[model samples]
Target: MRVAVVSESFLPTVNGVTTSVARVLEHLQRRGHEALVIAPAAGSPSEYAGAAVHEVPAVLYRRFPVGIPTPLVHRTLADFAPDVVHAASPFLLGAHAIGEASRLGIPSVAVFQTDVAGYARRNRLSAAEGFAWRVVNLVHDKADLTLAPSSAAMSDLAAAGVQRLARWGRGVDLDGYHPRTRFEPEVAQLRRSWAPNDELIVGYVGRLAPEKQVEAFSALRGVPGIRIVIVGGGPSESSVRRALAGMPVTFTGPLHGRELARAYAAFDVFAHTGTEETFGQTIQEAQASGTPVIAPRSGGPIDLIEHGVSGLLTDPDDPRSLARAVTALTGDAGRRARLGEAGRRSVLGRTWESFGDQLLSHYESVGARGPVLTRALRKVDVD
Candidate 1:
C-alpha cells in the first residue's frame, strides 16, 4: 500500500516523532510498500528508507522548525493519491495535511505522540492548555482514526472529546540496546570515565527541556555513592546545569547509535524525570538494555513499568520521589540486577516488526472502515 506520512518533526530534529516516522518508513520499505515523507525544511535528506521526502517552508521557533501551512501540502497529497495518510504528532503541518486528506477523501491516521496539553500544564500555561486541547481535538477529530502511544494519552484525548481513538505504542531496538553491551570495552570505559570512583551510575537520557523536569535531578545532590549522567541537549541546558551545580553530575550532551547504547548499558539504574511524556521511549531503551528504571507514576511510564517487579515507580507529585528511588537502587545491587533482568524480559518480543505489522493492520482497518466494515478498528492490548 502507498502511504503519505506528514510529520511535524523529522531528520535533523531527531525527537520521538522523527524516530517513529523513520522506523515506520524503514518497515514500509522492507515490506515493499511505497511511502512519501512530508516534513519541515531544515537541510534534511532528500530521501530515507526508499521513501521520497518532500520539504516544506518553515520558520524557526525556540531552536526548532515549525512548518508553515501551505497549499503545497494539498497539491502534494492530491498528486500522491495515497491509500492512507499517517500524521505524526499532528500540530501545524500535520493539521494541514490531515485537513487536506479529509478534503481528498483519503483515510488518515493521526498518531498522538506528544502531550501538548500536559506541557502547558507543566509550564503553568493554564490558559494555553484549553487552547492546546482545542487544536488537538480539531486536528485529531478530522482523521479517520487517531493512534495514541499510551493509555494515558488515550485517556487525555478521550477526555478532550476526540473520537475514533486507538492505542499504538512505540517499539525499541532490542539488539542495539541489550544486556551484553555492558561487557563491551567502550561501555566499560564510559562507566569508568563517568563514575571514576566506581560509584553507581544513575543515568537519564532525553531532552533537558522544561517539560522534562531535568531540574529534579538536583534532589540527588546529597545522595551518596552515585553519579548523575544526563544525555541529550535542549533549550533548558543552561538552567539544568545551574540546577544541578556542584553535584557529581556529568552532561554528555547528546549521543546516538552505539554511543547511546553504551551509555544505557553502562548505567546501573535509569531514572527518567519527565512527567508529561506520552510514551517514554527512553525508558523502553533502558529496559531493553537490562537496566532497571525509575520513573514517575504518571503518563506512559505507568503502562511501561510494573512496580516492584520490572522496575520502580515514584509519585509524580512528590519532589523527593526520584531521588529516593535512585538512592534505594544504589544500595541494593542484587535487587537492581533482578529488576534489570526483569525489565529486559518484559519488552522481549516487542520488536519494530510486530509494531509495523500492527500499523499495517491499522491502515487496512482504515481502508475497511464504514460500509465495508460495520465497526471501527477494535482497541487491542499493546503487548
Candidate 2:
C-alpha cells in the first residue's frame, strides 16, 4: 500500500511526534509498503527509511517550525496518488494535506497528538482556547478517521464534537532502553558526571518549553542528596537555567540514540511535569529503561501509570506534590525497583512492529469502508 504521511514536525526536531513518525516510516518500509513524508523544513534528510521526504516551507513558531502548504504539496500527492493519507498530528501542513485529499476524494486519517486548546490556555490565550478547539474539530472532522493517542485526548475531542475517533497508543524501543544499558561503562561515567557522587538522580526529558511546565521541576532543588538532570532544549532553556540557578541541576542540550538511552537508564527516578501531553513518550521510554516514573495525575500519564503500582502519579497543579513523590521514591529503593520492573513489564508488548501493524490495519479498514460508507457508519456509531 502507498501511504502519504503529512506532519508539521519531523527530523532535526527531537519530539515525540517526530520520533513516532520516524519509527512508523521505518516499519512501513520493512514491510514493503511505499511511504512518502510531507513535513516542514527542518533540514531533514532527503530520504528516510527509503521513503522520499518532501520539505515544505515553514515559519518558526514558539519552539519549533510550523509548515505552510504550497502548490507543490498538491502536485506531489497527485503524482504519488497514495492509497491513504496519514496525518501525523495534522495542524499546518497536515491540515493542507487533508484538504487536498478531500478534494481528490482520497481517504485520510488524522492523529491527535497535541492539545491546542490546552496550549492556548497555558499561554494565557484563554480567549483563543475556544477558537483552538473549533480549529481542532474542523481538521479532525474532515478526515475519514481520527486517531487519538490517549483516552483523555479522545474524550476531549469527543466532547468537542470531533467524529470518527479511535485510540492509537504509542510504542517504545525496549532493546534500546533496557536496564542492561546502565551497566555500560560509558553510561556509568555519564552518571558520575551528573552526580559526581552516589547522589540520587532525578531526570526529565522533553522540550524545555513553557507548556511543558519544566519550571515546576525546580521544586526538586535543595532536596538532600538529589541531583536533577534535564535532557532536551527549547526556547525556555534560558529561563529554566535561571530558575534552577544554584541548584544541583545539569542541562544536557539534547541527546539521541545511545546517548538518549543512557540518559534514561541512568535515572534513579524519571519525572515529567507536563499536564497537556496527549501521550508522554518519555514516560514510556523511562519505564522501558527500567526506571520508575513520577508523572502528573492528569492527561496520558493517568493511563500509562497505575499509582503506587507501576509508577506514582502526583497532582498536576502542585509542585510540592511532585517533589514529595520524588522524595518518597528516592528513599525507598525496594519500592522503586518493584515499580520500575512492573513498568517495564507493562510496556514489554508495545513494540514498533505492533504499532505499525495496528496503524496499517486502520488504514486498510478505512480504505475498504470507502469515504461515503465510512462517514455514514461513523455517524451512526457516534450517534
Candidate 3:
C-alpha cells in the first residue's frame, strides 16, 4: 500500500509528534507498505533516513524556532498517487494535503496530536483559539477516519465536532527505552554536575517550552536532596535555565538511545506539568523503565496513569502540588517500587507492534472506502 504522510513536524525535531510518527513509519515499512513523509524542509534529502520525504518551503518563527511551516501544497503528491493520505495535525501543509486527497477521490486519515485550542491561549492567539479548533474539526470531519492518541483526546475531538474520531493510542519502544539501557559517560558527568552527592534524581524529558509548563522543573529546587535532570533541548532551554538559575539541575542538551534510557532508568520520579498534552509518550517510556511518574491531572496522564495506583497526577499548573507529589514518591522507596512495577505492568501489552496492527485494521476499513488504491493503480496499467 502507498500511504502519504502529511505532517507539520518531522525528523530533526525532538517532540512527541516526531517520535510517534517515526515508530508508525517503521512498522509501516516492516509490513511492506510504502510511506512517503511530507513535511517542511529541515535539511538535505538524506536527512529523512528511510522514508521518502517531500520538503516544502516555509519560515519558522523565533519563539517556536523548531517548527517548520508549509504554507502551500506540493504537486508531487498527485504524481505519487497515494492510497490513503494520513494527515497529522490540521496546519497549513496538512490542510493542503488533505484537501488535495479529497479532491482526488483519495481516502484520508487525520491524526490529532496536539490541542491547538489550548495552544492559542498560551501563545497569545486567544481570539484564534476557536478558529483553530473549528479548522481542525473541519479537516478531520472530511477524513475517512481520524485518530487520537488517547480516549480523552478522542472525546475532545468528538466534542469539538470531529465526527469520525477514534483512538489510535501511542506505543513505546520497550527495548529502546528499557531499564537496562546504559548511560553515556557524559550522563554520569551530567549526574555529577547536578547532584554532586547521593541525591535522589528526579527527571523530566520533553520540550522545554512555554506550553509544556517547564517552570514546574524549578519547583523541586531546595527540596532537601532532589536533583532535576531535564533531558532534550528546545527553544525554551535558555529561559528554563534562567528560571532555575543556580539550582541543582542539569540540562543534558538532547539524548537518544542508551543515554536516554539511562536517563529514564536513573530517575527516581518523572514529572510533567503540561495541561494540554494529548498523550504523554515520555510518560509511557519513564513508566516502562520502572520509574514512577508524577504528571498533571488535566490531559494525557489521565489515560496513562491511575493516580495513586501506578503514579500520581496533581492539579495542572499547580507546581507546588506537583512538587509535593514528586517529593512523596521519591521519599518512599516502597511506594516508588510499587508504582514502578504497576507502571511497567500497565504498559506491558501496549507495544508499537500492537499499535501498528490496530492501525492497519483501521486502515483496511478506511481504505475500503473506494475500489482501493491497488485496484485503481492496476486499472491504469491495464489501460
Candidate 4:
C-alpha cells in the first residue's frame, strides 16, 4: 500500500518521534510498500529509506522546529494519492494531513505520541491545557483509527472524548542495546572516564525540555558517591545546567547509535523524570541495555515498570522520591543487578520488527475496512 506519513518533527531533531517515524517508513519500504514523509525542514536528507521526504516551512519551537502546514499540503498529498494516511503525533503537520485526507475521503490513522496537556501544564500554560485537549480530540476524532503510544495516553484521550483509539507502544533496538555492550573494553573505559573514582554512574537520556522535568534530576545531587550524566540537548539545557551547578553532572549534548547504546549500557541506574511521556522509548532502551530504571509512577513508565519487579517507579511530583529511589538502588548492588536482569528479560521480544509488523497489520485492517464499508453501503443502496 502507498502510505503518507505526516509528522510535526522529523530527522536532524534527534527525538523519539523522529526516530520512530524514520523506522516505520524504513520498514514500510522494506515490505515493498511506498511511503511518503511530510515534516518540517530540519536539514534532514531529502530521501529516507527509499521514502521521499517533503519538507514544509517551519519555525523554532523551543529547541525543535515546528512545521507550518499550508494549503499546499492538500495539493501535495492529492498528487501522491495515498491509499492511507498515517499522522504521527497529529498536532501541527499531522493535523493538516488528516484534514486533507478526510477531504479526499481517504482512510487515515493518527498516532498520539506526545502529551500536549502535560506539556502545557509544565510550561505554566494552565489555560491552554483545556484548549490542548480540545485540539487533540479535534485532530484525532477525524482519523479512521487513532493509536495511543501508551495505556496512560489512551486513557487520557478517551477521557478527552477522542474516538477510535488503540494502544501502540514503542520498541527498542535490542541488538545495539544489550548487556554485552557493558562488558566491552571501550565502553568500560568510557564509563571509567565519566565516573573516574569509583563513583556510581546515574544517567538520564532524552531532551532537556521543561516538560521532561529535567530540573528534578538536581535532587540527585544530594546522593553521595554518584555521577550524574545527562545525555541530550534541548532549549532547557542552560537552565538545567544552572540548576545542577556545582553538582557532579556531566552533559553529553547528544549521542546516537552505538555511542548512545554504550552510554545506556554504562549506566548503573537510568533515571527518567518526565511524567508527560506518551511512551518512554529511552526507558525501554535502558532496560534493553540491562540497566535498572527509576522512572516516575505516571505516564508511560506506569506501563513499562512493575514497581519492585522489573524496575522501580517513584512519585512524579516529589524530587525527594526520586532521590530516595536512587539511594536505595545505589546502596544495594545485588538488587540493582537483579532489576537490570529482569528489565532485560521484560523487553526480549519487544523489537522494532515486531512493532512494524503490528503497525502494518493495523494499516491493512483500516485500509480494508474502509472499502468493505463502502461496498456494504453500495449494496444497501442497490437493494
Candidate with maximal lDDT: 1
- Every model's TM-score: 0.95, 0.94, 0.90, 0.94
- Cand. 4 TM to true fold: 0.94
Write the residue-wise lDDT of candidate 2 on 252-300 in tens digits. Answer: 9899989999999889999999989999999999999999999999889
Best model per TM-score = 1
Q: Number of clashes in every candidate structure?
A: 0, 0, 0, 0
Residue-level lDDT of model 4, residues 1-383, one tens digit each, is 77888988888887888899988988888888888888988887898999888989889867688889897687667667677889998787888889888877668989988888997787788789989999999989889999988889989999999988778887788998999999988889878889999688999999988888899988887789899999999889999999899999899989998899999988999999998888899999999999999999998889899999889999877879999999998889999999999999999999888999899888876763344453444344335
Cα lDDT, all candidates: 0.90, 0.88, 0.77, 0.87
For candidate 2, the per-residue lDDT at 273 reads 91
Task: For model 1, name the residue pairs that clash.
Answer: none
Question: Distance from true position, residue 106, model 3, in Å?
Answer: 0.6
Q: Which runs of model 4 end up more than 4 angstroms from their true locations?
A: 123-126, 368-383
Candidate 1 to truth, TM: 0.95
Task: Tell me the alpha-carbon RMSD of every candidate.
Answer: 5.6, 4.9, 3.1, 3.7
Q: Candidates 3 and 4: which is better by TM-score?
A: 4
Worst 10 residues of 1 by lDDT: 374-383
Q: List the residue pairs that clash in candidate 2.
A: none
